[model samples]
Target: MIDLKTQYAGLQLKSPIIVGSSGLTRNPSKSKELEEAGAGAIVLKSLFEEQIEIQANQISDPNDYNPEAEEYLRLYMKQNHLQDYLDLIKRTKEVCTVPVIASINCYKSDAWTEFAAEMEKAGADALELNLFFLSTDLTHNGPLIRDLYIDVIKRVRQTIKIPFTVKMGRNVGNVTALAYQLQANGADGFVLFNRYFQPDINLKTIELIPGSIFSRPEELYDTLRWIAILSGKIPHVSIAGSTGVHNWEGVAKCLIMGASAVEMCSAIYQKGAGVITESLEGLSKWMEEQNFHNIAQFKGMLDASKLPNPTIYERHQFMKYYSNR
Candidate 1:
């Protein structure tokens, strides 16, 4: 039998197929189904920082707050919601057999550390920090923003003993440097990129429209390129490809390009949890055909370093090819 087991961030997963943070994992029954269908790990739907703050704001009466007291009250509410998230981790761990990774997003370094500790105490197998900051302010330079990430990682690392990974957006100007800093700061692994929900223009209504609920198949290429580029560059850090991985072909490609694992969200949303079984089976069959018995044997085989022309990964070759035709 082909071995589907793979290592991710020092944790041995039953398979390389992880159910990325989504609503599916939030439901105990759906999470159970995903595990039954051969998922290696499950990332619970992320608890948003904004959501917690919103809840806190609603609970606090404006009349009850002097400016100083209001600030204190907000901080208290944020901490309280984080405790609630810890409760989620405990509850999910009690029912799930596979690794339960708690996810958190926050702007403050202190919040990240405190919540990470709470998650560890709640028995989370690992933590995935979806670190996000909109780089819209002119006063903040890349180095400053990068420092925030380092600080966040450093503070959180001190609090939690469990393995932790970071999910980052692609907006950083110096991605390579940031990735290196994050790894140096003690991130066990890094998910290549996180897709942001971009609002669309509804010309007819003259209103901003919500982004697509699902990722398109074409979105996989961006992740593929980065994984291939960063794989050889950051060999020690486990890279997991995410966004638009919808089928076995995409999963196999990610592993070949040096990804330790591939995360699936949109695909699982499009197809049911059973898609995990199909993906694993397809990967196994492909591996057998390729004469490879395990994931590591062929992982990163197609990385840029291994390519005859490394520049192909960096340049837009499609335009050249089509123009020549």
Candidate 2:
């Protein structure tokens, strides 16, 4: 008998396969379909702060552009978007048997975070803050920018009673230190390395274009290295793998690196939701072959802290391999 059960951010997941937040999980029907297809949890489509702000900015009076009017418009837009998301949470919760995690994409600790409490009231099992800030300002220093992320988590923690996880970006001065600080500030869990939209240069047009929107399989290693370094280092904080998880093999790799669960979207987009069923079956067969009856038996077996030489994760250059070659 094989048991794939796992725990993430205090929620019991029958499997470690969570349908990540995207257009794939924007509707309740999609949520139900994924659950039926054997998904462990659903991270509902994120409520973007820019979505509200843009709508507010678009409204400018012909002759009189009032700051107060824009402020009121921003508030109204915020509430409208929040209500729609709350409705999604309530409806998805009603249809899906698995945990429903609400997501918010924000760059600052603004009033928008207060809506986290409202989402919990609407039946969201937990919250995942898709936190990212592209620091383009010349004056912005590393520590000052890091503080913004910390402040956002702290504010959200104060508002929501349910467990919340921070889905952070990989570009940081010291990821280990930031993870420790966020954990100290009350992050229940973390989804390693949020995938950002890459930009590509259009040679013919001499313009910038959006690169591939979906994560590729090769992107898994960046997240894997961090998971191996951070897992088991913190107390009571779960680590979730995100980005580049395309199949059961990818899923198993993350588990071995000490991830409690993995968030997948790009795979489902390319292969359909049936990939979930296939991955689960493949994982079970692999586990049986390895003589592992449960997830805990093999999970985190290769994390940096568990290995004899922890420096393996810290090594950046391929000098050793080049020398041997």
Candidate 3:
């Protein structure tokens, strides 16, 4: 019997197949079923910081809206989300033995950050900060934007006792440096690449529409490369791959590349909970074939940082391929 047990975000997981935060994870009954289906952990659907802010424009005129009423409504929204989220955490913890990781979509380091403490108190094993801004601000330089993420982590790290992770966007530059800085700032783990909603235009109506939310299996290469690069470098920081993982091979490949774990949501949305079982079973069979008994045995076997030819990852000019061709 092979042991798939691995630690992620400072939490011990029975397997690496964590159900990433999405609409599918919001249901309590479904969460229990996912655990039974071999999920190591489940991240609750994210509560957005923007969700609590008052939509002041809803009122046609400034004079028509009562200032006190607007403030009350904003407070109510925040509290409502918190109350329901806390209840979900409590109920999930009761029904499932696996870790229940609470996720929050935060773009700033202010009042919204205070909820981290409450989530910890409410029995959340760990918190996953889905830190990203769908749009960019031209006024801010790269350093300023980067510092925002660090500041958010520092604020929440001071507030919560439970372990926490920062889920980064794909466009983050100099990832090695960012990972090092975030680890120093108090991030227990780093999830590579949070999938964002892709916007598209409808040619006929010229209206905006959403592109595919699901990640393709081929997209795994981007995450695989980073995990291979960062795993050995930041030994203290746990790495979990979020996008492009859709099968048992992807899970095994992630572990082999030095990821502490891999998260799956698109697969669940496409194939339902049985995908978890298929992933776990295939991983165990692969492990047995490779003469390994546990996850750690083969972990980091292909890390670029550990290799003599580490420059292979950085050489993206394709000169060698062209010459060979």
Candidate 4:
């Protein structure tokens, strides 16, 4: 039998297909089904920072300039929302054999992070911090924004014993440097890219509208390029390819490029849970064809550092190809 096991942030997963945090993983019943369908691990739907703050504001008087009441309401709202999340973790753990990872969608470091300890206590096998911040401010520079990310990782690291992975957006000036800093600040691993809410124009209406929320298979190339570049560069840190991994071909490519795992959200949304099983079967058949017995045998085989000519990953503009065409 081909060994399909892989590790992500020190968690030994049965397969490389981790269901990314989304509505599919919001309930215990759904988590159990995904596990049965052969998901290596499950990332619970992220508890958004906006959800807590918005609820708190509703309960408290914004006109009243009372710090004490504000603080109390913030704590109350956090706890109320957190209790549901903690319950989800606890109940899911009871029903499923795979690892249950708690997720937090945060923009800044604050008291809400202190609740990471509570998540661990409630039996979360690990934590996935979806750190998001896009600064359009004129005063903000890349370094300052990078520092803020480091601070958030540091705060959570101080509070939790379980291993945590940072899910980062691709908007930063320096991807490798930011990854290095986050790893130094106690990040166990990283998810290469997080999809943000995109806006589109309604040509007929002449107004802004929400863009397609789902990621297409073609979007996998960017994540693939970065994974191949960074996977070989970062030592002892696991990298998970995310956003646009839609099938077994994507999974095999990610593994070849040295990714420990690949997270899928849109794929699962478009296809049903059976997609997980289908991909795993496809991977096993492909491995047999390639004469590989285990994942590590071919993992990172195509990474930039391993190539004779490493500049292929750095080439941009594709002027030569365009000219020939």
Best by TM-score: 4
Q: TM-scores across all candidates?
A: 0.93, 0.95, 0.94, 0.95
Q: Write the per-residue lDDT of candidate 2 for residues 64-173, one digit (tens) a residue.
A: 64777667776787788789989999999999999999999987688656789899999999999988787878999989988998898888888888999989888766
Candidate scoring better on lDDT of 1 and 2: 2
> Where's the lowest-lDDT run of ten residues in candidate 1?
106-115
Residue 120 in candidate 1, Cα distance off native in Å? 0.4
Tell how far residue 305 is off in model 1, in angstroms.
1.8
Scored by Cα lDDT, where does model 2 land?
Answer: 0.88
Per-residue lDDT over 1-325 for candidate 3, one digit per residue giving the tens place of the 0 to 100 score = 7899998988999999999999878988999999999999999999777766643234446566598876666667678768898999999898999999999998777876678888999999999998875446678677877788788888988888899998888877778888899899899998887988889889999999999889899989889988888886776668998799999999988888889999999999999999999999999999999999999898888887678877666685256667678
List runs of model 1 lying over 4 Å from the truth. Answer: 64-80, 316-319, 322-325
Tens digits of per-residue lDDT for model 1, 163-202: 9999978897767688888988889998877888879988
What is candidate 1's CA lDDT for residue 127?
93
- Clash count, one per candidate: 1, 0, 0, 0
Candidate 4: which stretches are off by over 4 Å? 60-74, 316-319, 323-325
Task: For model 1, state the Cα shift of residue 122 in Å.
Answer: 0.2
